[model samples]
Target: MKLRKPVIWFGIAMIMVMVVTGVVMFMEKVNVFATGTALSDNGWKAHFSEPLAKEAITNGYVYVTDRDGEKVGAELVLTDKGRTLQVEGLQPGNYTLRMEQKAVNSQFKSLKKKKVDFIVYDSIESISSAADLKLYFERAKDMQSVSVSEDMAGSSEKATMESAKAESSDAVGGGDHSSTNIQVEGVDESDMVKTDGDYVYSVFGGTSVKVIDIRNPKKMKVAAEIKPNDDYYPTQLFLHDDLLIVLGDKMVRYPKRSASQAEIMPMNSLTTIRLYNIEKPEKPVLIREIGVEGYLKSARKTDGMLYLVTNVHPYLWAMEEIEGDALRPRIFDSNEKEKEFMDFKDISILPGAIDPSYSVIAAIDLTSPKTSQLETKGFLGSSDQMYMTKDHLYLTALKYETSTNSRGAEIMIWNPGRADTEIFKFKLDGTNVEFHRSAELGGTILNQFSMDEYKGNFRVVMTEGNMWDERNPSKNHLYILNENMELTGSVKGLAKGERIYSARFMGDKAYMVTFRETDPLFVIDVADPVNPTVLGELKIPGFSNYLHPLDENHLIGFGYETSAQKNPSGGEPLILTKGMKISLFDVTDFHNPEEKFTEIIGGRGTYSPLQYDHKALLQHKKKNLFGFPVSIYEEGEKEFEVDFTGAGALVYEITPDRGIVLKGDLVQKKASGQQYEEWETQVQRLVYSGESLFTLSMDEVKSYSLDSFKEISTLKMK
Candidate 1:
């Protein structure tokens, strides 16, 4: 009897020990640590001592909630080898993170805390000077060993305006000529097409800049060509008076010694800016060549000053041993033996941003007779988009909270896919560019049109969440800020489940397009800057990827045509996209907006570059001419497959009275070698010079009479 009693006591003791050990194992070893104080575009991450199971971090257990106790939708991505939890989709607000007593680790044990608290501040801190930039780089270097978050890796690789003679009657009013679509009245936007009232400058075959003399349409020929050296290829061009600016990249491949033999190593990308005096059209004199270590992100020309932005990814891994001068970007004057790197003092960065990439802004004064000198400023971040006004220049970059090695702090972070935008402003004072102010916003912008400066208030449109996500999907937002880039008023949670496809700001009104299954064109009233409101929305069959303003009351949209089909076993209809779509929207009555006209071209896989690149669109309001390069594709015998048919320029006459009328199709005669190939003779641009219209293809430049649409001449590009 005594032995039985002792056995029971021993079993009871073992049970007690097991219960205590299990309790300890269930307890969370690490507290949730967050990096930034606010929730940013790249949502902040929550770091636990040990990675919890992905299934455990759910809306029911681990999530943020509003003051009303409503759960704020967020995307939780397990990163750092399942050790860190990345949280996205949380907007700026005070919220409680509720982790139930049952919330467990990877082993399915409960967390120690029943609930945790955190506040998503309204804004993020921005850097001030070069010293701040240095510190940011220092921190990014220290975090080299940390794994890059998947959410951060998924953030898109960070992949502008008019001039006055642009508003002339021949340019805008009631003229029979077409011009490059521009943003501002006086600022000239660089394009594949630039007409100086007599000649056209077009990039040919992505190899040379061809000057076409349209003075005599019957004999229009390539007057001159500037073929860059083998190392550099010009992609975009800007013309001011007699000076033509060519912007491109210079890639240098050099031999590097390996363990056994010498190997050719490709150097870092270098942005190449070449200034040429084209006063003598037949011969362009290379006046200056500026080579900076970076890829040209964007550039703008205002008041004879060219503001160029370049994003340079330094050899950060070997930054310590790199030559100090090599760390800076270099500029070489024409005929000068010495190359000058942008001074260290000229580089300044936004504070708190952890981007290792350097954004260099260089301002060149075309008005100055001394073309050798250019003022440069550098920022330590990644630039995705840029917007420039007559007085100010805005460079926007996105930094995800989950990006690897962005900061030096040892504390694990809570950054998910949420991103924060850094807006760096520079004052355009005549010929000099001066750094103005830097600010931060939460969310990712679409493009240059996503940002606008109205009445001293800066307005922007951003998208949150994953576009392909079906569970917690994407949404759009419109934010208004003062000159300092501080958020004043915002209208968020728009088009929930849809991502922004296009945005356009005209004066006090902004038009935005979002898409998933259907396209919702939202008209926002920002006249009150402080209280921006969504006036109305027009749902359409397809989405617009680029929006162009026809007037104060009308907008022209270019995108794709989509149709939805129900599955045999129904859930959500499968959306099938096809063709190229153009829409004319009338917002004359804010309350009753309508798609006045819509035109779908081709079938299945038909595509237009203009849908993805605004530069491909050529418009002339006065001439009622609108055209873009399109490639026709037909559906094949197999489902979801297509075959190329033809490529050309589709010109349309757009007018309020007549609507959209097909002017004519302009196509280039195929090259002699590949004449039968469908890809041959693909027209890329259309330019109007006087009464003649010119269509540019890789193989040739064809001219047509504006009135008759008859081929006037064909100049072989080669």
Candidate 2:
């Protein structure tokens, strides 16, 4: 997961006094970026140079950092063509590096500041990685376009003079040399897990967990390491049967315009719950991990039943133990009605109604009045719940209204087999539910859903609607019940922004998978169990998140391509887009559904999809071709391009074998499987048994060999 370079952790005499006080004291360090210099609307062309920058033009340059904003002391060099940035030994205070004062070509210009303090052992130095790769090509000139290839550092093919449109537009034409996205702030990472056979698992920081055994995918062996003495980590998980359910420290969803911003998740790591017990194939037994008492964030489990939904903590720990010792944080227990939290900020609702949250985090204080420790400025937060079936633990609740205008909350079905009860709460009768603020372009607005169904009846199917109103979707509310609990009634007009990620009823029509501007597969009728009618929709361009039904008239839609584009020559492109079809479609004409087949998986042409979230989407069709495990990095410098997502969680299986680069049956040679491979160190999640595969590398647990795959020993999780 590593890639967090704010120079590792900022502070080299406050970045040599903000880069020698922004160029000897502001007056010439405005909006600077070099490689070729950027900030163009057409006023700063071709940015990518080292020994290249005299065709000069700049209203920016001067930088330094270390308060968590690395790039210290002096650096504004193009050293004849190799670029240079030697900022002395470092040790300063006030700093600078400002850019904003452009009318020359307007890409935006309105920021400037340059403060100084330079005083480390005779003045800072050292900026050579090649002068920090030439100020990262002048901050990749306005950052974020990622490969359009004009020469983009040569080598994706295109330097020929043998023109014929140079192969019709310099290498495939849609144009992109692939490489850019440098928020470079600690190497932009979130998930990493790759295994066809040889073990690999990851879940880092915010807390930690690891395991590895590359089984010779070339070599990497580290097996075993899981820490949680009680600090909080593990944000998402699901591995039923042998039991291994973990989901901690969350901020998973947020956009319903501040869903009551409190960012909860901390009390003894959310009441601490690790619970491992891998039925020992080679040894995996944490035995029993239970840290009971509410506030637990997101989780899912079936064939065992454990539905949960809680963040009701408003108790404030007996008055911070009588004031003066005031601390915060309360882990595991979003269920059981437990309540005693302080702040962690959580507000997700994109499928409908919920908002409020903008900077609030404080939770800490496990069980015994554990002395002082609550220094939160870190902004750690969490939300989003679903424990599909292991007894049904669903979540989404509201009741802290701030002004009125609708969408408050109510939808939290828990039934861990009764002993852990709550069972019902659909909420939303309208007094005026407005809840705005989550339109970050397509993410939060309350749209929870559930269905793994062993016998079918109804585990969950949430909603909130008005998703820009796409043809009246029955308005909202469709709770259908069955797992022997029964409700089977209340499927009304739901078509606002369509929010039921999956429903597939069929015997009376149910389809579902709704969204507002994209991601559609609607088709409702519920056989009229109460009032469910929409009967036709199917958009599909990207954003279905997850869906599979196969029987009942054939239905399967994985589609998920994120958005954001404008280049004909307008530039601002930023795509990471991943998750493509296995599609199939044939809803027996849900209003005309007949596609039959399509398959194209993995990064290609991506121009705008800002990472798309809700854990982006994973699969559990058990096996028929469903994938979600990624690791694709377009990586650094074209200026603000930042596309190195660490790349690795890729669980591929949809192969009748046509091409993604295979053919090693054991090895006759042709193996390109397109793997991510960028590890120097850092892996903390991956699980799968039977054919073999397991991982975690903060300490232990490594086994592998799904055929010819490698890596064999290293157990410990206990």
Candidate 3:
């Protein structure tokens, strides 16, 4: 009897011990690993001294450490220069010496909390080097190992705006360069999800939108796809709780002129703004239609307010009918330029140009007034441009009514609330032939022509090849507008305007990145907006598409940082460099934003200053420069299934950090053989509500669950 009792006790004790051990290990999610022999003795693989390759390595996550405590704690990543600590979005300026202690040890198992103290050197010199790598967070909710976050920034909220601006300030935005890591809380892989390229069919025009529910990322299902009304063609879709507002061109019953124009040719007179009641997302109902006199092309939403700042839509590319066809110019005496003339410039002038149409600022107050407010949107120039800062909306406008071409476009500020909308306008005026030209660059425009606001001033930056007598920088301009929307000051004649493309604002300075030539980044101290001085320049090879400012001293540049002078596309020896890299710097000394730690974690994609949860969606290497392409990776599966159009996207899990998951195929259809085949069909846009990834391509909206990345439901337009 005594032996039986002892044996039973021992068995119970063994089971209890096993349970406790499992609990401990499960709680200790973070495991420190030693330097694997897989890593080459040279540290970096042979060919990747370039910034992009280095960034990919840094992002590759050499080591994964967890903060064993609350939501906040230090997560140290292995860098060539020991362990660098970042806290509260700031680097602690701490360092270490030849600190090779237990290269990979689970000493963290003893950590009562994630907070641990490591050997530190406060000196800046011993800090080794900064991360010269590009960073981006691929938010994948299905895969926790990726640690990407979503629900960080909302386009329509002020808090979202401020934080989004801050994200831009981070090296991601090129404002603050001292910060390196963009902690994404989710996983972004080419697989892990199945984009069963099958979608339902519909032929509805623009009145269609895909409805999604984003609370539960894992089990999300497509509730419905609705086509509110037939006549209204939606141009853009913005989410508002249950309602999905569609921005489109509508025909006014009283305004017969526009209706008549449309009757003449369906493409002539287009409507501006319209609203749909999406309370039943699956079955969208038309609440009311709001149409302005003119047409609208592109649109964006931030907060509950919808800004359908009107612009011209390009549908006119018709040639003037020739009375008699002849081949020769001199032989026919018809004064012909070319027998087969491909005229793209004149296309904008025909029926597509916005020179004749004016825009309106319609604040669709979804929260307050049932009746939407409308005002003359007094801002101009053309399409593919326009930005809002503070309460003022800056746009490119022609100097006066006399000009015809884009060179007439300059910077202007307008207030939607104000009755007299034209607050101020800035331009560099000169004579072209016999006409006075007042435009962004005084004559012709330059690269990625854009406007940005720093402190209180607005600066215009772009790429210009050659201008007038100058060959270096085509043109760059800076204009300061006060609270009254009046130009308080201005500056022109940029030194490196020709090569630059993307730009961002820091405290009192701005950074401009170049695309062509010796693409170096230039810093401009705009303390004196009228006479802004160039701080210094950081040169990297290839083009600089976007700049994410981590701090005043460091900036993360995305886009290919080529190894050779000529690009691989130009018959040059293909150098497999880092597609995405993070470049750190000591920007406290902005005289020159010094390159510090540059780690290439992966490839580089877009310069979207995106946030979800708390982490930032770092940088992604773009497979294609022009279009949005998504690659899929199955969970626990290695390798990617790259799909161009069916590039599924899910950014619904917005939270304290930048974490969200985007997966699935782009060309989503429900019919057999209707799968996403790049050669057969093209895909449009994608939307997400946690689990169900709703992809709206062409007339179809397909849904996929986050748990299995499988297509669940599909809605075709009516």
Candidate 4:
């Protein structure tokens, strides 16, 4: 009996030891399972619990197959210390990542899991129906965990103006005159000031459009003023033949019922265009008015058709109580005599667009403004920069995705986990506009100048990463896409650690400037649609913000001259801007570009509107003359301080033989104890009519003789 009892206890003890050993072995076996998947610029990443064996990662052990189990040819790379398996070169579709048990070492296992379903897509998917859009909003609300009311706010409009071109006339004062400096030749943009050689039409004090007769330079006088109602304030003007088009903002109020039953009214802003018959300079008659709900994004006139883009953000959160037309954008036409909401059939969603906003585009037949109809369409998305050709219009939007880290903290990051630009293209035919394909590039565009369309291909320059962030320094890239928005060629990883300051695309080549400690101007050859290469590079001491073509082989750069100073923080030297710089670059040699001439003005605190607004510059190509308004400041006795010197307009004659020569200086004298610029006296624009040059400011307009540089007349505007 004693022997039986002892054997029972011994068996129980053995069982316990076996259980403990099994548990230890299982814990050390290194079982792996996919935690999640992420998309990057290079490829798709399948994250696992533990690092994998390098030799076991191969097509035989790890591969991707389509939804039907057909194996896809892709390059497999083990990254993140074998914790991530990268699958590249796969087209957009649903796929399954199959990792065989053999992919793990003999001492490891895969938790008996063989496949992980995933998707490889680069484009955005459109919302299928109203139900789908509601689901989208619900998902967005769930993810954000915030009230939509917090996202609602007032939006401001941007002023983008252009110059005017007049036909050659035989009148005494009608000679070859300069128009608004523009990017495209045939595309006309609206500006605050426009001229038709004999008359200058300008927006004065944002209240009225003034028609100044410039036929007699010494007797320049205001001939007429078109003043609108208090609700409409003019911002820009465009002159087409005998028609004067004025663009401004109009305020509309919506009555909101309060909790106490009181009516509270909120103002909403809309873009309005007023067309006037200016056959007689003295008496202007209003022809018609066109209005669209939202803030004006941009406008372009070509082939006697006007295209307007506006961004409309309605009270989407009000969908909880209100529905239908109340949340949709509206359009007003004088012919209709009433405002109408946009049709649902005319509204489409951009792929991956999460913002509850609409980009409304309207086409007006300016050729017959009196009886023409308005055709407009709305897209649910947001656009930052716009570029257009005679046949196509391109809009770019920056999209960000939300991701969670190891700590479960949500972080907002650019789409694809990099700085990406989502671009949409539209085909423009006369007064008809249609949406084309869209694409996603791995960088952010600088401005409208960063994009261009050539013979059959579209090219763009983008800057990736932040220049101030050392961990992921900036790098520039240039991409070429086909008419269908398919990737054709690219020059990636250019100018590492520097961002693009300026980019300009010529016929067969592209000029780009990137800056950090020094400016590196790159000349890229893009003639071959499938293989673009860097032709040359020039490193200089400053950067260029705007680039203008002087001729076929020459270019002009406008920006700031910078110098390196010792960094008190002790890493890289600090870049100290010295003065406003003008450089003429010679690229006659495709393999070697040279800065032929350079001119710097003032020191420390010198600025010109031409640096930010290209229309502020005056270019007389016939005379090889260029001028802009500048506010000059000099370095003070204390460190990091400057003293205001003066403000005025300066003109220079730049030629290949003579280089850069000062032609005229019309600086306004600073009053005693004037330590800052006077807004009223600051020159804002320079225009030339025949042999006379006019400088316009808020207070007055002054005319100078182009031949003698003598002041002829001054007309008070205020």
Write the residue-wise lDDT of candidate 4 on 1-718 in tens digits: 2669889999999999999778656643332222122222335655444567787565388888888999888788987567557677877778888777667655534323466665655543444455655554444433343211111111111212111111111111224776776666678777888898888888857878888888899999989988776789898888888999999999886434455323344567779999999999778899898888899888888788899889987654433444344556778888897656666667776654555577888999889999988888888777888887778899998754443333443333332213456788999987888887777676788777788888879899888755655545567899999998889999999998787888878888898988889999999999997999999999999988888777768888888899999989898899999999999999999899999999998898898998888888788877788999999998999998998989999999988778888899887767899998988878988888999999988778899999878899999976
| Candidate number achieving the greatest lDDT relative to the actual structure | 4
What does the lDDT read for residue 464 in candidate 2? 34
Q: What is the number of backbone collisions in each predicted candidate, taken in the order shown?
A: 22, 147, 140, 4
Q: Given candidate 3, what's the lDDT at residue 466? A: 38
**Candidate 3 ranges with C-alpha deviation above 4 Å:** 1-207, 214-220, 228-231, 250-266, 297-304, 312-357, 376-384, 398-449, 454-456, 462-473, 481-492, 549-554, 563-588, 594-718
Model 1: how far residue 276 lies from native, Å: 1.5
Residue range 1-718, candidate 3, lDDT tens digits: 2579889999999999999888777543221111110111111110000112123223432222222322222333333223221222212322111112223134333321121222211211110111200000011111112111111111110111111122232212222111122211111111101121222112224455444443344344455555545565555444455554555555432212343343443233344343446554456566554543345533334345454445532122221211111100010001222322111111111111113223333344555324544322322124334455323444443211111111322112111111011112222111000101112222221211245555555555432223222322245555555433345565555654343455656657766654334466667777776677777877765544545544344554444444544554775344433243334444566676655554332233312222111122322222100112232221222222322222233322211122122332332233444333442123333433323444444544455654455777654433
TM-score of each: 0.79, 0.28, 0.46, 0.81
In candidate 1, what are the lDDT values of residues 443-537, reduced to their tens digit? 67767777777788888888865655553356678888887666689998899877788887877778888887999999888899789999999
TM-score of 1: 0.79
Better of 1 and 2 by TM-score: 1
Better of 3 and 4 by lDDT: 4
lDDT of 1 at 620: 63
Deviation in angstroms for 65 in model 1? Answer: 27
What value does the lDDT take at residue 171 in candidate 2?
11
Better of 2 and 3 by TM-score: 3
How many clashing residue pairs are found in candidate 2? 147
- Cα displacement (angstroms), candidate 4, residue 380, comes to 0.7
